[model samples]
Target: MPADAAAWHAWQAHQHQQRQRAAAQAAAARPSWTRRLRPAPPAPVRAATLVAALVAGLAFALLLGDGMGPGLALAALPAMAAAFTAARAAHRKARPWTLAWVAGCAALLVIPALRDSAWPSTLAILCTALLGALALHGSRTWPGVLLSPLGFADAAVSGIGWAWSGLHAVGRGSKERWLPVAKAAAVAVGLLLLFGTLFSSADAAFADLLGDLMPDISLVDGPLRIVLFLFGALVALTAARAAAAPLRWDRIEVAPGTPRSRIEWALPLILLNLLFAGFNAVQLAVLFGGYDKVLKSTHLTYAEYARQGFWQLLWATLLTLAVIALALRWAPRGKPGDRRFVRVVLGVLCALTLVVVASALRRMDLYVDAYGLTQLRVSVAAMELWLGLVIVLIVAAGVFGARWLPRAVVGSAAGAVLVFGLLSPDGMVAERNVARFEETGKIDLAYFQSLSADAVPALDRLPEPKRSCALRGINDELSAAGDTPWYATSLGEYRAREILRERPVTAPYEVCSRLGSFGSRIEY
Candidate 1:
């Protein structure tokens, strides 16, 4: 009888081994892409994900509805914390630069809470998102910088599956432990209900206190709130999952362009360089010769010439950058002379392009002086300046080697954006225009009307009617916004409120209408 039992156990073990071997073979036969999905998270990670999701959901639903203010910062906290926690749990060591990127993202989220201008706030939010993607899955390669947006898209699309997996893991935990906890929770709820109802009925003050302590839940908005909660939860879960297993975008390889002979590459660039040189020579002559020379040559007013050719020159600068990129790709490297020739032609082209950039900037300066500074003018000038910086970086790479060029370019751009936001662009514009007004006794009252609350301090410097006219739109917007919750208040809005309260717009219409026709009218 004992022998028979041992024989039966042996037969079962052999069958089990055969089944396992078959399953392994089937898995190996599956497509390569199918194997790329990460394995299911462990129980501890699943539990942490669930908790983080709940926190994110509550934060988003409660704090994000008021406006773009401290609420944004508050809402981002849980997701950031969860991402860090997941990284630690997965035993992933974050690079030092990644922390800097995260810190930058955090600072960006605070920008909206400080400034009320649309462009600054918009840029801050957009930059924060891009930086977040970089912190999560960024690589050092140029391709990685270019492809960071796609990483975010991939995470968002996979977030639902990640959330479901987490929830399922939590649900599959031990029933016995949860059962007793559930029973205890039910009993506690019953006891609270019974005593709370009796106490409320016995004393009106108790009922009032209870009502004040409880959150007000509306039936009408319940569905919308639930959707918001789910969205936040999904976001948190996906971020945690992504941090645990980041996509290696730097590993992607790109084929270099076909190499060409020195003549093939050098001929076109040489002609392009000649064209650039000729244009730059004329620009330099006009620059040094003053508006009289421009008037004689172009038969146009100085401002007209400045405005007419500035946009074209900017486009030409951009195209030259692209041409340089293409030229470098096909540049000959077979001989030392070939390399030197490539350098001379490209270097000359770059130096000439710098002149074009300078000319474009000079033209914009003249235009601004003749007319007045506008948001568009300031923004374009900044862009042109950055493009010039990019060219300089390219030149440095040509001399010093280009291994660091990609990251340096990306870092410079991010720094430029941060500086732009911190500068308070709208306020700067207002200050410039105000100074111009004081000097020439000419202002654009209508243009001032379009500025945001960031310009409040500058506009306050204006006298009487001009001040009242420039501040009317901002005043109206603040008044319409009413008394927002503390979490939704911006520094710009708060200061504007205080200023307007102290010196309210008295006789706004009469003073504004009288002075409106006096300032310079901006055509575009």
Candidate 2:
């Protein structure tokens, strides 16, 4: 029985060898073209690359669209879509949360408020993509989440590396085979250009038609487009690849051989905290006291008073953040007393900084009230608010320790960006300024007219005469678009154009006093 079993095993092994030999011979027999020029990348890489390329193309096409805001919103679709396409390519099985993240991103894109503000729209798309990638890869680590952008950027480099590797894998002899084709193509292009130019120069009618057909490509813009396309493609590809294989943060935290003494870190923090406390006390007594108190303390007008310290306060908050980070880095974590004191100082510092944040926000509010909101003002306000939130989180970290601090900070910051983006700052600014005009019976017509399509919806809400005057520039530009193709249509531009069509501008004003590139062809 043992002899018979051994013979059977030997027969099976021989059969396996025969099959492998036959498969190898068949593979070799196949024509060179029948095989891939390079080994096909894994399914995920292929899918991600193709999807990213397509989306990037779409984004570029969208840039030629009518309104800056909607055009930007549409352009960000590639980044958002990459998260979904990459996840589908990588994992065979996906969680419900992954789907939710993708869905949430799609929902945000469609919301009118988010679609009309370029900055907010772009930020929201990035946040959504990052969140989606995280969910798909099952990465919840704070450090990794915070470093998502770097990972995405690295993925592009990795892809380029892969390309290099594939090229190296191709035999050197293969290059000779394609050399003739390359020469032929180059010769053909040169001959065509030479002949075409000569033919056009010899015949006036041909020259006229050729000149009409050719696009006016400037020396700068012609090269610039190609460069931008290549860069954008690389970025999109990297983002797609990163979604599939999320980078993990696993650095070993090495303790310093000789830690600095507590006094070195604590003394500065204590002094800084004391200074902040004094400032906060003053802010409470004067800044938050009352309009009358502010008026009495500073002889300057309300706007001037509000404007005085905002830039300074902003710089202080940023500098304080840097100081805290440096202090924590050097401060001894091993000693319980040292750690406790450090935490207390940080908490107090963050608390005081919040007061500074509040004062900055108050100043910005007062200034906006007096002068009316602008993109710069709104953006600064939102940024300061986010900073204040970060400070709160820092204080929480001091109390609770750092286990979830990184994730909380990243998530909160992302949330803040999304919230602000959804708020449609441009439209909000326009709406507020229009309301201010109604109250004060004065408006900054120049500023109002300067706003982009994000302000269109708000401008549409205004009563005539003011509305007509406000939209005069926009309407002229819209008219000068010369029947834009459907491919370049945008929500903001479409809405603005429709409003103008419905309510024709009766006010007399120079059409596009400062004509943009798109409107330059029209006889103004």
Candidate 3:
């Protein structure tokens, strides 16, 4: 009997050794990239992640049902918290730049709570999402900056796998441990329902209080709420996974283009510079020589000349950026003289492009002065300004080393967006138009009608019927919106409601009709 038992133990030890060898062979057979991928998190972390995702989902379903407002910030809180928790659990340190990007995302999310303008709100939401992705898996390289959003796809796949594995684990031994707790919860729920129903039936006020506390889930809203819940859970899970194990986008190598001779690089750029100089000279002449000289030379009105060339100049400036990029790619890199030559030529091109940027902006300014300010005009102008800033940063990068250029450019863009939101662009448009109207006795009432609640204060400054007429659309919207919930409240909407309540639009239709074409002009 002792000899038989010894044989059985030896056989079991041999089997365990064979299983370990097979596992090692399987691991070795994996592709290099697959081997580099992060392993699944520990069981405790997985359980925590699942709980966090469910909480985030619940927050989203509750807070995000309303329009864009403070509720967006509230809904995003759980996901951000889960990301931080997962990162900490995985022993990943948050870099300073990543933290800054996260802070910027938080600030951008708050913009929608402050302003009701469609453009700013939309931009804020979009920028926040991009920034959030960058916070998770940001790279300092230009390629990485451009490709960081791809992490979302990776995270989604990883998150789904993580969830499936986690659920399977829970179904194994975890069920037995949780069974008693589940039973206890079921009993507690039963008791609460019985007692709550009896109390509610006994007191009218208690029933009203209970009704007010509970969410009104209708048949149509039920599916939508479920969808929102699922979406939020997915987002939280993906974000946590991304924070724990960020994709190494910078590791994807890009080979440099073949270096070119100095003549091949310098000649075309010199000619481009001359062309730019000639155009800039004409622009300068038109700028300093006034509208009379433009009329004499082009036989066109100031506004017409400004309008005709601004779009073309804008395109030229954008193309110049592309040209500079390509030129740098093929730039000579052999000698000291070659480096200097590259810098001088590309610097000249960038300088000339700056002139073009200035010309485009000047033309836009002249056009805006001629006509009233619109959302399109303001948006284009802001874009032009940002592009010019990019060119300036390129020049700086050329002078200094370009190691920081990619991240700097991205940071500038985010800063520009933040500044744009803080400035309240819709308010700026309204104020500018109002000032123009006061100066020239011309106003585009139809444009004013399209402005959001952010423009209310400026529109309130208008005289008599024009003011009421300008505010009628916004007022009607606010009236129809009825009462806003606290979570869904926005500063712009609240202020507009208050202003309208104090001084409602009085006989807007009659006044607007009496003014006829003078009140609102059709924009061509």
Candidate 4:
């Protein structure tokens, strides 16, 4: 009986072994095996990262070390976007949401801080794209909830780094997370103050350094703008093509079959950044506050400034190119998170904006007597508030997000005004005036000229003495700085008060004048 039991156990063991062997053979015969989606890591290229960092440092020295504030600020947008894009791509299961976030950040940079625009179409696009990417990519945290508020967070009283860093912190939070932001803010402020101090000293020591080099050298052939514009165009094309490409699940971030050597990856980017940094440094040394420098010294009122603006634009284009080149290089060539298509579209849009804005900026300073009552009363800030808001909203809706936002904002603002008019004590007389200006530019003139009792009361309410005094100050400034010659012939009755009285006029006369460009004037 014991022998029979042992034999039965041996037979069972032999049967189990045969089954295992059959299973192994079946597994080996299977083709195109796949793993359930899992978290992955970026390639380990330590040397490339180090090289990129070194190159960025050199760029900081060449460009940002000088006393240019706005350039640095503008440059930070693309730079941060590039870094975010690269970092997000370094992962194996690359997130599409990260690309959306990057685009949103880029859009935010374009939103003029001084303008009163709504979240621009560009901003909306960025936000929507980012949100979509995040949604598709599946990250844990909402980045905009934390970062978007930074725009409004800027105020002198907000944080120590607010003055320097631009990102005003509300207060301290997770020390590990907040520490980098705080330090970055401090460094920015420190560098700005230091540059301002050094520039002040340099200007006093080397007067020639303050002058425009273009006039002296007559370096006419080296506009560099055409090259820049063309380069920008190419980048834009690349981005467009890439963005046009699809975002398939299979196309997500995965390991490269043959990884690039670190030095090889970084060399092009480092050198490009260095070139940009140097070019921008030269631009800073020459600019006189504005992109253009009006040189009255050469007996040249030829708006020597426009030339300067052209040069600045040229450099801006070059710097933009350098940044993109760096971004492409540092990007894991052929990696998953590398949204080559999305970036290409953005690059084109960026170039277009730069060209349009630079053209407008060049035309701005040419207006004659622009410092007078008209320009002062209707400030750029006021116009920008409405126009920028509208542009921003529309752009966001049409280009980046749902196309309904622009319609909603426009409808809302108009509806509010209409409702206010129906309920107002003034019976919407203000609307009448607004309409008249847009249509006829008469400005309630007939109503006032009829000697309406309300007109005189309204004029008196304006505090004429203070108004006249301010107008006089404006006149004096215009005389000294304006391009147009004041003409008594153009003045009408009430507008020609001081000049007519001539009663030992201690201040300048108040008279409406036209704007002009160069040696020309546009009389009304």
Displacement of residue 132 (Cα, Å) in model 4 is 4.9
* Pairs that clash in candidate 2: none
Per-model lDDT = 0.77, 0.64, 0.80, 0.34
Give lDDT tens digits, candidate 1, residues 1-524. 45644564465456446645764576578765433332333223445555677789887776655567777888788888777887787777878768878888888887888888878778778877777777887567777777765766666666566566545544554555346766996899899989999999999999988865443457776776688787787778767767766666776667788889977888888898899889988877776887796698778887898899889988988998889888888989888888888888999999999999999999999999988888999989998999999999999998998887876787677777778777888888899989999999998787776778888999899997778888887888888888776667788888888899999876457677777733565564
The per-residue C-alpha lDDT of model 4 at residue 240 equals 20
Model 3 ranges with Cα > 4 A deviation: 1-44, 170-220, 514-524
| The candidate that achieves the highest TM-score relative to the unseen native structure | 3
| TM-score, prediction 2 | 0.66
Error of 2 at 9 (Å): 25
TM-score of structure candidate 3: 0.86
The TM-scores, one per candidate, come to 0.83, 0.66, 0.86, 0.23
Clashing pairs in 1: none
lDDT at 323, model 1: 92
> Which candidate do you rate higher for TM-score, 1 or 4?
1
Report the backbone clash tally of model 2: 0
The 10-residue segment with the lowest total lDDT in model 4 = 484-493
lDDT of 2: 0.64
Which residue pairs clash in candidate 3? none
Q: Between 2 and 3, whose lDDT is larger? A: 3
Please report how far candidate 2 places residue 370 from its true position, in Å: 1.7
Per-residue lDDT value at 300 in model 3? 85
The Cα error of candidate 4 at residue 144, in Å, is 16
* Candidate 4 stretches greater than 4 Å from native: 1-126, 129-133, 136-251, 254-274, 287-524
Error of 4 at 34 (Å): 12
Model 1 stretches astray by more than 4 angstroms: 1-44, 174-224, 517-523
